[model samples]
Target: MTLSFDGTVIVPAADPDDGERTAEALVPHLTPTSSVIIVNVIEKAGGAPDKASMEQREKHAEDIFERTRRPLQSTDAALETDILYGTDIVERIFAEAQDRTADAVVFAPREGNRLAELLTGDVARRLVKEASVPVVALPQRDV
Candidate 1:
C-alpha cells in the first residue's frame, strides 16, 4: 500500500551549521506519496523590515529551503515552499496547519534552551502542544 500524507514542514530561517542536519531528519519518514509543503514563517513587525533586511531574510529562507529540498527528492517527493507572516510563529504554524488540512507538521527546533523549553515552551514546543495536526519537532545535532 502506498502511504500518503498531506504534510507541511516548517522550515524557519535557520543558520548555517546545523540546518542541513535538521532537514535531513525529516526526509526518511516522508514517502513519495507525501504532499510536502515547506513553510517559511515570516515575522510580522509593526513596521516591515527595511528593504535590505527583508531581502536578506528572504534570501536566507530561500537558501534553507533549497538545502532542505535536495534530500526529500530522493524519496521521490516534491517540496512546495510557502511564506507566512505573523507576529508569533506558533500561531502562524497552527493557522497554516488548520488551513492546509495538513496531516503532519515538521519543524527544526531552536538550539539549546532544552530544559527551559520544556518548562516554558518556546515556538516549537508550544506549537507541538497546540498544533491542529501532529507536530514532528527535530532538534539541532551536536557537532
Candidate 2:
C-alpha cells in the first residue's frame, strides 16, 4: 500500500527546536500535496495567568510560528500554524489533528527528567499511544 501523510507537527514553546527537527524528518516523506500544520500549545495549567496575558502569549506563539515556517516552506508543502491554550495539551493536539483531517502527527521526542515527566505527564509518549492518526516522532540524535 502506498503511504501518505497530511500531518500536524506538534511542538511546545519550551522546545521549539522540535518543530524544526520534525520538519526535517518530514522532508523525505512528504508529497507536494501534503498539508503541514505546526502547532504550539500555550499550556496554562491554571486559569488566567497573572503575568503574561493571552494576547502576549499569542503574539509570542505567532513569532515562533514565523520562524518555524521557513524550514517547512523549503519542501513545497502547504503549511499552517495553530496556537492553542489549555492544560490538556495532548487533547488539544489530538483535536487539531482530527479537525485538520491529518493522516499523521509528527513530533520530535523530548527527553526530560522523571520529575518533569511526572509534572508535565509525558505528552509525547501519550500522544504516540493515544492518537487516532499515526504519530511519527523523529528519532533522537546528538547535536
Candidate 3:
C-alpha cells in the first residue's frame, strides 16, 4: 500500500548534518509509489527573533535541504520538504507525522532514550514510544 513516510532530521550543533542515512537504514520504506516528506525542525527563538536571525535560520535549513536533497531526489519515490519551528522536536515530529497522515515515521538515533532503554534523551526512543504509526529507528551501528 502506498503511504507517506516521515523523515525528520535534526542536528543540535550549528552544522547541518542530516539524520538521513541512519533513518533510512532503520526503515525499509519509501517505495516508488509512496510519497516522502523530508522535514527539518528548527527551534525558533520561541517568541521573536530578529528578522535577520530568522532569515539566517531558514537559510540554514535550506542549506541542509540542499545538502541533504541529493539522496531523496535520487530515490525513485517523489519527495517534498518542510521547515517547522518547535520547542521540542520529538513532540513536533510525532505531531507532524500524524498530521501528514504518514503511515510510518523514520528517524536516526539520538542520545535520548528512557533510562531503561540503555539509550540515553534520544529522539529515536521517543519516536518509538509516541509515534502512532510504525517508527523505524536505526541505532548507531557501524555497518
Best by TM-score: 2
Model 3: per-residue Cα lDDT over 34-104, one tens digit each: 66666777765567664357678788778766655565565666566778778776677667877876766
- Of the two candidates 2 and 3, the one with more favorable TM-score, higher being better, is 2
Candidate 1: residue 61 Cα off by (Å): 1.1
**Shift of residue 126 alpha carbon in model 1, Å:** 1.0
Alpha-carbon lDDT of model 3 = 0.58
Please report how far candidate 2 places residue 79 from its true position, in Å.
0.7
RMSD (Å) per prediction: 4.2, 3.1, 5.6
Residue 15 lDDT in model 2?
Answer: 42
Q: In every candidate, how many clashes are there?
A: 0, 0, 8
Note the residue pairs that clash in candidate 3.
Answer: 111-120, 111-122, 112-120, 112-121, 112-122, 113-120, 113-121, 113-122
Candidate 1 has an lDDT of 0.65
Best by lDDT: 2
List residue ranges in candidate 3 displaced over 4 A.
Answer: 1-15, 23-28, 45-52, 110-120, 139-143
lDDT for every model? 0.65, 0.70, 0.58
RMSD of 1: 4.2
